[model samples]
Target: MNVFLGFLYVLKIILSSVASIFLMIAIYLLKKLDVFHINLRMLIMHALLCIFVNNIIQMLRFAISLSQNIKCSSHNQFPAPFCAFLCINGVFICMERLYATFNFSKYENENFSYFLAKIYAVLWMILTLCSLLKFWEGILPGRYNNSLNCELQMIRENPLKTQWHLILTLLFFW
Candidate 1:
């Protein structure tokens, strides 16, 4: 089990790093070429960059923890909040895309630029709020187990909330 977990961790780190790199390159090209004329596209790219940063931070914190093994710090202090941001951002994007699909004609009729801008703003505010949830009450530093692994905790700390969020995320994808 330990070996499997270790392998998973290594894979997670590698994949995250590679994703971050590709995302960064894409963002760079977008900015350099001025390809994205739409406000929504720019915001989506910005959110992608945010996730990229989140993944890099997670990888760094995990590496730091593995190397330092500092006894002073608790577990959740490492990468919990950013991890939560990643999950929330993902769900928010998925939900937004769903909404966009359903509201296609409405989006086309109205000035979609401002509409997208509003969604982008609201989604980012929600992401900020979700990330702060950890600082407020969601974080449980001492509890390190399968019930609260790094990925699961990204959704939320409350088991019921986590379960609901997971279901909702899956439904949104569907």
Candidate 2:
């Protein structure tokens, strides 16, 4: 058990390190270009943020196991980092979808800068509500599988728990 846990810890460290590297590159690239020029930046940031969240989640997971005094009893946990990642990522994905549907005409027009900013604000609010539903109200599935040493559970196991993830990964990429 000790060896297995140690191995998992090492794996988590490796994954997080790789993610941090990618995140650094992504941020650097974003600095060099505008948001429109590097749309992939949003996706990369979402992935890195999720990875960082997962690292924190894993630490808390171990700590919860080690400390019997902790009162939280959800066997399937959703740490704050993952929760925040899910919320942020979900909102971004939704906003992206909305843009696709509407063709983002207002955003493309120079005169629509103020309206576009408000659209972003609305997106933030929608994501906040969705995240509250996912995390606090249990609108989405809560049980996350641990078969693989990875961030986010398998879609098969958790279903639409990461609905936005699936849409972006499958539909957008295709």
Candidate 3:
């Protein structure tokens, strides 16, 4: 079991590194591509950035654990928030698409200002942080064994908090 787990960790590290690189390249290309509207492109780039950062953090965590032979829980909180943001970003993208669909005639000529895109990104960041703050509070101190693995299960100790996280995720995803 230990060997298998080690193998999985190595696999995760490699895959995450590759994913982060690809996402970086994709974000660069998106910046150069003129096909997408500015607002939509910004949203897509934000999503990609979130994923890229999350992957890089995960890769680093796994690499540190393997190299130091210690399971560090300190960095565990880093990825969950980004994951939440990605979910929220997905909802924003969907909403933008729906708006365009409903107002197709006006959408073609509509110029969504870059400021609006920045606002949307900031709003999503704030929302994700607020929601995650409560969730993290439930698990951060005195909640579970500090050395135990699988931080996801540790966060589940408080069912109410877990439900809140799930509700938000499902709400955005739905």
Clashes of 2: 0
TM values, all candidates: 0.51, 0.42, 0.67
Q: Which 10 consecutive positions of candidate 1 have the poorest summed lDDT?
A: 69-78
How well does candidate 1 score on lDDT at residue 88?
60
- Provide the lDDT at 172 for model 1: 39
The model with the greatest lDDT is 3
Ranking by lDDT: 3, 1, 2
Pairs with backbone N, CA or C atoms under 3 Å apart (clashes), candidate 1? none
Off by over 4 Å in 1: 68-126, 135-140, 146-174
Model 3 C-alpha lDDT per residue in residues 66-95, reported as the tens digit of each score: 775654444344445655776777787898
Q: How far in Å is the alpha carbon of 156 misplaced in model 3?
A: 10
Window of ten residues with lowest summed lDDT in model 3: 139-148
- CA displacement after TM-score superposition, residue 147 of candidate 3 (Å): 8.8
Tell me the tens digit of each residue's lDDT in model 2 across 23-43.
Answer: 667666665777752333454
lDDT of 1 by residue, 1-174 (tens): 255555655676798789889999888787677564444455557566666766775576445434543222223433334444445656656655676789877754443566666765776676667656643442345533432255365455675543554455335322
Candidate 2 residue-wise lDDT at 163: 47
